[model samples]
Target: MSKPPLIFAVVVVIIAVLATQRYMQKRRQDAVNDASPVRTLQAEVSAKREFPAPNRRSRQREVIAAEEMRYEVYFRPLSGGAEMMFALPEKTYHDMDKGMRGELSVQGTRFVDFRPDAAK
Candidate 1:
């Protein structure tokens, strides 16, 4: 190949390598950023006794009766005026009824984006 052409080819290869390196570096930085813990708000319901966990999954419509009973709930904010009840998955009604306070931390999506039953 001609001298100028060879030089141009070498320059193109160097540019491509630098670009790839930069892209990889940015990807690593992004992963680190994503792994960092996100901030969230907390609140408590003092009036109630314990938060109820429905027998059925939230996807299925199940009516929770107010007259039956109610419980104090500590929750993070959810969409609209609603909030999610934070509790143990394996807990029973009596366990939930024990009247106590709790704490929670949420991340990723906005508090407003959370659903009424979005606890895990």
Candidate 2:
């Protein structure tokens, strides 16, 4: 083939390869995003209260900073050392104290199915 035709073929091949790569990358990202869970578990280490008996319960009071807003996080550990964090949108850190109670739930993290307390 002539030099011009050979060069044009090479350019077309390169363009095709680049386009395919980009498409594949986008597809992979979309698949990951779709498979990921809506919420994930986060790791936190601090002093907390625990309830040893069935009727009696303890609380862990701490301050949390979220998006320029400060709130209090309270957690009460159950029988098996499992604890749940709780906070209200209208409550501040200073408002929390002993004798307060609430219910909370834990969630998994990332696209992979793992426990809530998995090490980050």
Per-candidate RMSD, Å = 16.4, 17.5
Tens-place lDDT digits, model 1, residues 1-120: 646778899999999999999999888876765676765443433322444444443544444564223433445333234555533333332343222333334443212211222345
Best by lDDT: 1
* Tens digits of per-residue lDDT for model 2, 25-103: 8888777767755643333322333322222232434433332333335454433445445433433334434444332
Candidate 1 whole-model C-alpha lDDT, 0 to 1:
0.46
Per-model TM-score versus the true fold: 0.30, 0.31
- Please give the lDDT score for candidate 2: 0.44
Give the lDDT of residue 75 in candidate 2: 50
